[model samples]
Target: MEVVATLAGMSSSRTEALTPSQVRSARAALRALGRAGMAECDVDGQWAIRADASAEHAQSSATAYRCVHDQVVEERCEYRAGGVSQWSVQQAAELKANRAREQAWWDGLEAPERAERRRARQEEFAGLSVVEQERVKIELAERRVRAGVDEAARHDAWVDGHTMDAWVRRSIERQYRYQRLPEPLQQAKAAAWQRHRERFGIARGTPLATSRREHAAALPSTAAGRDEEFLLVDSGGRTTRRDVETG
Candidate 1:
């Protein structure tokens, strides 16, 4: 007769609910070919009892690694717990072993070989574009910042040669922060930008004009007659008004 068990309370009083720890004990009993009243069990809270079943049938789904004192056992025995597959367990074990072996091999390498490897990696990095290099630097810096090894900065002397305030001002001048900047910062940045344009003629359809228009439009209640001062002057010293379209 085939009998089964599950996490759900057993239907018959003769069957007892087994804890995860009891799985191996039950499996050992089932594997003993001549053992009487033994039940074939799996780690997935499942078991079966058969009057005509043999030890081979009981051990077919078993792993070659054994679980010892609830610790993992390596080689020729199966670790059986929590329904974890033997193949997956073996793969993890092998990966860990391989990492150790690789570390040992690397440690045994000659100084020259290690130096050459470092030089090769440096060369590969040197081949990247300036923009790509800057991106890598920012990513590394951000990682360092997250690890508390460094403080986050918008720019560094070697990276962009601009301080955070300068970067924000530049972003505003480039129209990248027209609507994004705080109202006060936007007005201050716009005033500073207007001074720059007066000193150096504001070109039509440029970031300066676009940002000014956006700033004015965003605060129409306060921008009455304020936008009139933003006039584009040509090389001939004549003022020409041009509407710069926002993208």
Candidate 2:
């Protein structure tokens, strides 16, 4: 009743159905669900929480590595409730967000860009010691078996029967070795992406994509396998890259 009166005071015609105090209480309760990521909605006694807004919000925000704002808030609440340090909670969030962005960036690349990355990465892999290379191969093969990305019969045909028919097979086989293996292996395949950014040397919270075009990296020409510094003139004719770092 008090909530109704408070709502009435705010706007008698619009909020006749609710007490301001009750609305305040409900809103307070909703805030604890801060991590639920649902934006606050005005409850004007409309059809069932404003026509399925929660479901719509969930569908709209669904994306890689994002837990919706409400969920994020809820996680922070949990951390707080459990006596976890604020720094730890913040660090975990930062790491999770960074890794997601990196994966999204990698996933968004065109086939040619991905191929070029693979070629560049292959070069990086070759720089490792022979023992390290062998270990990575073994790790990758095991990961393939566990992931069911390829069946044992396929491996048997390739490994035991030597039935590989395409040159691309080796490349695909090599890439997944690291692609599938997160530094430390995970029991569940779904959660193993934690260390995915480590493979690319991306720092935590760095975006994989950006609206700023000038910050784009130049893909090195791999044919000659040589390094050269180039000059970049921006739209405003601002000299940006001269093989140097600027603040």
Candidate 3:
């Protein structure tokens, strides 16, 4: 549920195609749509905003398309051609197919199998040390964020009618949202996230792998050794601690 902007015909002479005010207004409108679960919008910024700029500022008068979903080709106003671009369309289709496969796999699991799966996961959670358990909690929290972003991305892909990389990057971006920070700090956090993703080889989001039963046998599967303390990160990128009674 986010608006993805694309300049149909862009030029380097201009830092932005639309006026600063227009960009702000359009962005606000798109966010409103997201909140309401609205699908598509054509702001006609190319006509309204482009009319004000001279040829020197605007590369061309090509229509600027802003979609609630991802766009296949991100035309920067460098040069816009008339014919339809095919790359983005193909990507979106692929993503949908992949998601369907994942859903099917989950739906095919039997009741006993699912119960065993849940048992296995709890065992894995219990096996970690106190510190590792805390880390896993953080990871799970981030995964929740990723799920939301995926929904937003799906909206974008459908509305824009184009292909795009999965919205995995949103998980990292959502972390600094609670408070405004200086540019340097923002850059520092982004760098830290990059290192973490690389270290863990988790640039893309996926379902967790099931641990071998033999390995899980060594771990306590019940709540006996579980710590009640949980670190939670909310949608606003705010962090808080909560302790649940294991009893």
Per-residue CA lDDT of model 3 for 85-140, tens digit only, reads 46545755666676578779978999899889989998998676545765675575
Worst 10 residues of 3 by lDDT: 224-233
Best by lDDT: 1
Sort by lDDT, best first: 1, 2, 3
By descending TM-score, how would the candidates be arranged?
2, 3, 1
Where in model 1 is the C-alpha error above 4 Å?
Answer: 1-83, 126-247
In the range 2-89, model 2's lDDT, one tens digit per residue, is 3323543543554355556657765564553333443343477321222233554466557533656666787678787886666666
User: In lDDT terms, how accurate is model 3?
Assistant: 0.44
Q: Which scores higher on lDDT, 2 or 3?
A: 2
Better of 1 and 3 by TM-score: 3
- How do the residues 1-247 of candidate 1 rate in per-residue lDDT, one tens digit apiece? 1122232233243365565555554445445633533455468746565566555645652433233423444422443434655667686677667657867998999999999998998888768754565556556554544433323232222234544334333433344325546888667656654553343343333444355455535532223222332222223342444432221
lDDT values, one for every candidate: 0.48, 0.46, 0.44
Cα-based TM-score, every candidate: 0.21, 0.24, 0.23
